[model samples]
Target: MTEPGQGQEPERAGSRAERLRNWWRPEGTWRRGIVLAVLAVLLGIVMLLHSRIPNDVGNLGSLLETFLPWFGLCLPLLLIAAVLRRSATALIALVLPVFAWVSLFAGQITDKAGAGGNLTVISHNVDADNPDPAGTSRDIVASGADVVALEELTSAALPKYRDGLAKAYPYHTVQGTVGLWSKHPMSDPQPVDIKLGWTRAMRAVVTYHGQPFAVYVAHLPSVRVKLDAGFTANQRDASAKALGETIAADPAKKVFLLGDLNGTMNDRSLAPVTSQMRSAQGAAGDGFGFSWPASFPMARIDHIMVKGVEPVKAWVLQPTGSDHRPVAASVKL
Candidate 1:
């Protein structure tokens, strides 16, 4: 009996030693990667309070908001690191960013496209130096849009577009660098002063099915990112303010604004416009609907915004010769 009890004591001591080893090992899930846990929390805070970030320095807040959707990529990267480090703390902290991102953008991932729309409109920034203006015009015709808006039109290429689109669109108007063409009759066409001293914006009343609505084509001043000046968007911001005022003053109840806004809906600088209008892509699009740098669209600078109209569906078209892809949207009214 004494010999059997001695063997049992040795076995119990061995089990206690194994438990101690596990507590101190690097593989312990709860005790490792405290720094990683802190970083995960910080990431979540930045995403959650993005709107509060100051834009006084480099328009940093607007810039981050422009690419806000891309921030989700960090979650998977941090998740891999947490797993490798065996950090239960970091893994739990990561839930904040995951929840914030999902809450902000999960609806965009699900298809919101529904059928039954009366009008289809297309907007494109045909590059000033496009190598194939005629081909681009042909592509626009193929899109089967009832109304088309083109920006950055050059004097040399304007005739080509006019000729290519003549039969399909007999009623058209051009003001400075932007133009609008519609199958329906257009009246009261005039250039809008966006403080640019040139015709980069225009408004016209288009009669559709005996009902009239105001259609605006604008190419807001472009923004540039400079190392010394940060986001040089003061000029664009001024133009946006002026354009928004003009749109607000219009007596028309239903309005459509199309062309290159040069800023996304998320950018606070464009709030003058975005505050009053609704983005077709955000309301009823299939996906992100990025439309710039045609080869690889990272942001959506071009827009189809509406007031007092219902967006049915929105989508991006196949690439044209221009640097920006065309955007098309259908509306109920």
Candidate 2:
């Protein structure tokens, strides 16, 4: 005879196997989490066809694209819910979004930075209301950039930055609110009209290695999201269009655009500009080079884009007194 409980072991094991099978049956797994499955599929479709989303209504498409990367967060939440619901359908549906997200951004997540470049450039939207413009200038100097472009310079803070960066960057020009400071010589500085009735953009030719390249500095109109108005970016959008036309008409073989665009590269409204140039951060940075809200950068409103130049590396500099973080890049001139 067997031990008292030994005979019942086979029966218990059989019962466990039956229960597992029942949990996976169509009635148990497929019937549940249908909502979650649909949501996952919809997310996949949205990310894959983000460009097709119409922007005419409330600039909804542009708004969604601006923070597109953040949508990845939903995947994990969906996964947890699927597991709790014991839904095989939802688990399988998650693959669609996972694949879509990876296809769109996997390359960006990888380390693409390489070792060397001929010129180092930096850009910042030094807040107009910064408490310490002098200190912010010092922080920029420490970066050892060959070229520096600054935006949002207020009349009150101008003297401080000028006094602070004068020694290191002897060649500098201030046109309206935008400025460019360079170790090398700069000339033909003028304000660019972005149809704002005021100067918020400027351009200069900087001579590096005895060759000149056009450098544009612009501070596009700020955007806002109001309960009734939706994404208030009409001014910014119009400015971007005008700026693109100006850049296209430039005769320089090599060009560099630096400033606070108040929009992302993903934003379709910026296509006129982004289409013609390559983003240094997208090509060379290790990660998302977000440079806004110095305290907690969520997006890369500040940019260093190039035309007819090779980007070697890109990065975000440490925070300063300004509300925006500084962005830097190295490129082959």
Q: State how far residue 67 of model 2 sits from its true place (Å).
A: 0.5
lDDT, candidate 1, 1-333, per-residue tens:
376566887799998887567854665556587778888898889889999998899888888888888889999999999998888888999999999898888888777887899999999999998999999999999988999999999999999999999999999999999999999999999999999888899999999998899999999999888888788788899999999999999999999999898988889899999999999999999888989889999899999999989999999999999999999999998
lDDT by residue (38-133, candidate 2, tens digit) is 999999999999999997878889998999888999999999999999888899999999998998888888778987798999999999889999
lDDT computed for candidate 1: 0.92
Q: How many angstroms is residue 140 displaced in model 1 relative to the true structure, after the best TM-score fit?
A: 0.3
| Model 2 regions lying over 4 Å from their true place | 1-27
